[model samples]
Target: MGLACAVAWLAALTVYDVRQRRLPNALTLPGAVIVLITAALAGRGAAALLGAVALGALYLVMHLTAPSAMGAGDVKLAIGVGALTGAFGVDAWVLATVAAPLLTAAWGIVGFRARGGGATGRIAVPHGPSMCVATVAAVAVVVI
Candidate 1:
């Protein structure tokens, strides 16, 4: 039930992100809180919180250093995404965190090329979808 909810939450966020290019705090924050609590009940609170902090911090740094490339919403979304993967263990968390940017970069490169390579000075690819995908993928890998 919790897993299904998380999947639906991520799916909704993914759709919103692709359409609007923003991950609203209302959704992201609540999801994080729910997942964190769930993780705690599941006896993985500390590690889950650490995962949230770790991935959230990483995205925060990216947002701070390159605001154009990373958004504040993505930073917020990372917390929940991290916790989801973190519930499995460090391996899932690390894999999700590492894969997110790579997936986003791939999207950026492919999108840039598809757009004729220089129509805009920068590609505005949203990172939330990639983050969500990475979390799902990592958890799937770890679990199966």
Candidate 2:
């Protein structure tokens, strides 16, 4: 049940981010609540809560230091991702955290090269998709 909810949540966020380049609070806030509730029900509440706070704080710091690089929405979404992966274990959370940035950077590089290599401003590559992909991959690692 938790896994299903995580996948569905990721799917919805991915679609929204791809289309709008933003993850609205409407989805993220409620999603965080749901992830927490599910984790609690699954007997991993403590770890999930810890994961949410730790990862959220980490992202908050990143956002504060570099607003252009990490958006507010991404920080909110990280709470849910952390909660979900943290339910599995610290290893899962760490894997997802490590994977997301690497995946995002790789994708950004591809996108940059594709755009003719002549831009001075930030390329609006959506981080939500990369986050979702990393979360799913982390979950797979834990499950399998």
Candidate 3:
């Protein structure tokens, strides 16, 4: 059930981010709640849910320090990833951190080239979708 939710969330994020370049808080915020509730029922609430929320909050603080680099939506979405992957331990975090941006960067390159454009500051690819892909990939690596 958890994996299914994660997959669906990733798919939604990908479509939303690609088309809108924004990850709605409406989606991410409720997701964090669901994960938290599930983690609590699983007896891993503190570590999985609270910990993830802390991580998300920390990311927000970091973003505040460097708004030019990260966006608020990414910070909120990080909480969702943390909630989902937190159950698996630090490895989940590590995998997600590494994979999401890498995938996003790679995709951005191809996406831009396909549109007959080059990378520039004006073109900002949403990080949420990349994070979503990375989250799924991370889960797959951890599970199998």
Q: Which is the leading candidate under TM-score?
A: 2
Candidate 1 C-alpha error for residue 92, in Å:
0.4
Query: Which pairs, if any, clash in model 2?
Result: none
- Model 3 Cα displacement at 110 (Å)? 3.3
Candidate 3 lDDT, 1-144, residue by residue in tens: 877976897788779877987778888888878877887888878778755876698778878998866788889888988877776667876788777778878877787787778446235667887888878887788888
What's the candidate order when arranged by decreasing TM-score? 2, 1, 3
Clashing pairs in 3: none
Sorted by lDDT (best first), the order is 2, 1, 3
The 0-to-1 C-alpha lDDT of every candidate, in the order given, reads 0.90, 0.91, 0.79
**lDDT, residue 68, candidate 1:** 83
Q: Find the candidate with the highest lDDT and give its number.
A: 2
RMSD of each: 1.3, 1.3, 2.5
Task: Give one digit per residue, the lDDT tens place, for model 2 in 1-144.
Answer: 767877988999999999999999999989988989988988999999999998999999999999988999999999999888899898899999999999999988888887766766347788988999999999899999
Name the lDDT of candidate 2. Answer: 0.91
**On a 0 to 1 TM-score scale, where does candidate 3 land against the true structure?**
0.83
Of the two candidates 1 and 2, the one with more favorable lDDT, higher being better, is 2
Clashes of each: 0, 0, 0
Alpha-carbon runs more than 4 Å astray in model 2: 120-122
